[model samples]
Target: MLEVRDLVVNYGEAAALRGVDMTVRSGETVSLIGANGAGKSTLVKALMGMQPVTSGSVLLDGEDISRRQASDRPKLGMAIVPEGRRLFKDMSVKDNLRLGLHDAAARRRGADGLDLAYDLFPILRKRSRQLCGTMSGGEQQMVALGRALVSRPRLLILDEPSLGLAPIVVAQVFEVIEAVVAQDVTVLLAEQNMHRALSLSDRGYVLADGSVVLEGTGTELLQSDRVRTAYLGES
Candidate 1:
């Protein structure tokens, strides 16, 4: 559903991404694994049109969207649960989720999509009237995920969904993601937790210094000697 080829991004003289190539087919989950500063976020921003691409193409469903505006992507059936779960602190939970329906189709889905969100995370329905900032980290993450899903996106991109949560909560978040995958939403996950990322993904790519260093099926990567040494901390 999504393809990025020879993608490069530069900050003045420094290149944040160089010749990165990856693909997420329809009805599949793909993971991008890398250490901090490996250009995962850069790639995400570029794909979403938040960052300008110095070169290369971002194709969605076979059309080039590289030059499209950031605000235009959501209308084209793309949504993101960004790193850090950026949310409105003072907004009620329902109000926060309602922001996802910016496009006409999403707005048309309306309360039906809201129901889907609540079904995905029942806690969100209970907290509908509560302020978002006062919620726990796990709760906030749930809100972020719900916000993305309520948009009825065809391609869902998640950045660091496991960051700064207890192990149990992280597991719960992964479970929710798996549930989403069961519904056949194409997913592109950028995560630092190599084990969890690869485990949930059908295929995975490793990025280093802004380039794709390796690519394989999740199980293949998990058992790779190079991956075991570099990312898995094993010899």
Candidate 2:
């Protein structure tokens, strides 16, 4: 469903990605795992068009989207749940979710998508009229996930989903992810928790310094010596 080939991104003279290549097949969950400064985020942002790619290509459903603006990408069925669960602090939970739907009727009435969000996370329905900022970290993350879901994306890209959350909350988030995958949404996951990421993914890619160093089925990669040493710190 998504493919990035030899993508390179530079900040002035400093290079972030040198030649990253990865692909996510339809109806599959793929994880990208790497340490800090490995250019995982850079590769994702390049695909999202938040950061420009100096060279190479990004393909969505077999079409080149390398130069497309971030705003334009969403309407084409690509959505991202960024590392930080960014939310409008003062907005009501329902209103925050309403911002995600692009349909004029749904965005105007907010009834259709709001119901869907409520179904995904019943907590959001209960907190519909409450300020988003006052919610707990887990609640906020739920809201972020709901917002992305309401848009009905074909390719869902998640970055560092477990960051700054308790283990229980992180597990809950992963559960929600499995639910999303069950609905046939393709996932591209970048996560620091190598174990969790690899466990959930159908396939895995190891990123090092902005390039893909290894790729294999999740179980295969998990048992590999290189993955153990580089990411899992296991013997």
Candidate 3:
């Protein structure tokens, strides 16, 4: 459903991503796993059109969208739960989620979209009117996930969804992700939690220093000596 070819991105003279390539097939979950500075976020930003691609092509269903504006991405069946759960802290949960409907088609189904989000995380329904900043970290993360899911995107990108939550909360989040996968939404997960991410993904990519170092099925990656040593800390 999504393809990235020879992608490159730079900040001034420093290259943040260099000649990277990736693909996400429709109706499957794919993981991009790496360390803190391994350019995972850079790749996410590049895919979402948030960071300028120095040179590369981003294709969605064979259409080149590399130069498309970020504002237009949501309309192109793309949505992201960005790293850090970037939310409108001062806004009500419902209002914050409303921001995800950036196009007329999504807005037309806004009511149904919201219903689905609330159904996925029932706590959100009870806290719909609460200010996002007053919510706990786990609750706030729920809002972030809801905001993205409310758009009913075909391709969902989750960047560091487990960053600051407690272990139990992280498990809940991944359970929700599992449910999402069951719904046939293609997912591209950029996470540092290697085990959880790879375990849930159908395919996985290991990024290091702005390039893909390993690509394989999820179980294959989890059993790899290199992945165990580098990310899983099994060595």
- What TM-score, to 2 decimals, does candidate 1 have? 0.96
Pick out the ten consecutive residues of candidate 3 with the lowest summed lDDT.
102-111
Whole-model alpha-carbon lDDT for candidate 1 = 0.91
lDDT digits (tens) for residues 1-235 of candidate 1: 8999899899999999999899999888999998989999999999999999999999999999999999989888899999999999899999989988877877765547889899989989998999999998778888998999997889999999888888988888888888888878899999988998899899999999999999999999999999989988989
* lDDT agreement of model 3 with the native: 0.91
Q: Give a tens-digit lDDT track for model 3, residues 58-164.
A: 99999999999998888888999998998999999999988888689667656588898899889989999999999987788888888988978989999999988
The Cα error of candidate 3 at residue 171, in Å, is 2.1
Candidate 3 segments whose C-alpha is farther than 4 A from its true place: 109-111
What shift in Å separates residue 116 of candidate 1 from its native position after superposition? Answer: 0.5
TM-score of each: 0.96, 0.93, 0.96
Q: Which candidate model has the greater TM-score, 1 or 3?
A: 1
Candidate 2 vs. true structure, TM-score: 0.93
What is the overall TM-score of model 3 with all chains considered together? 0.96
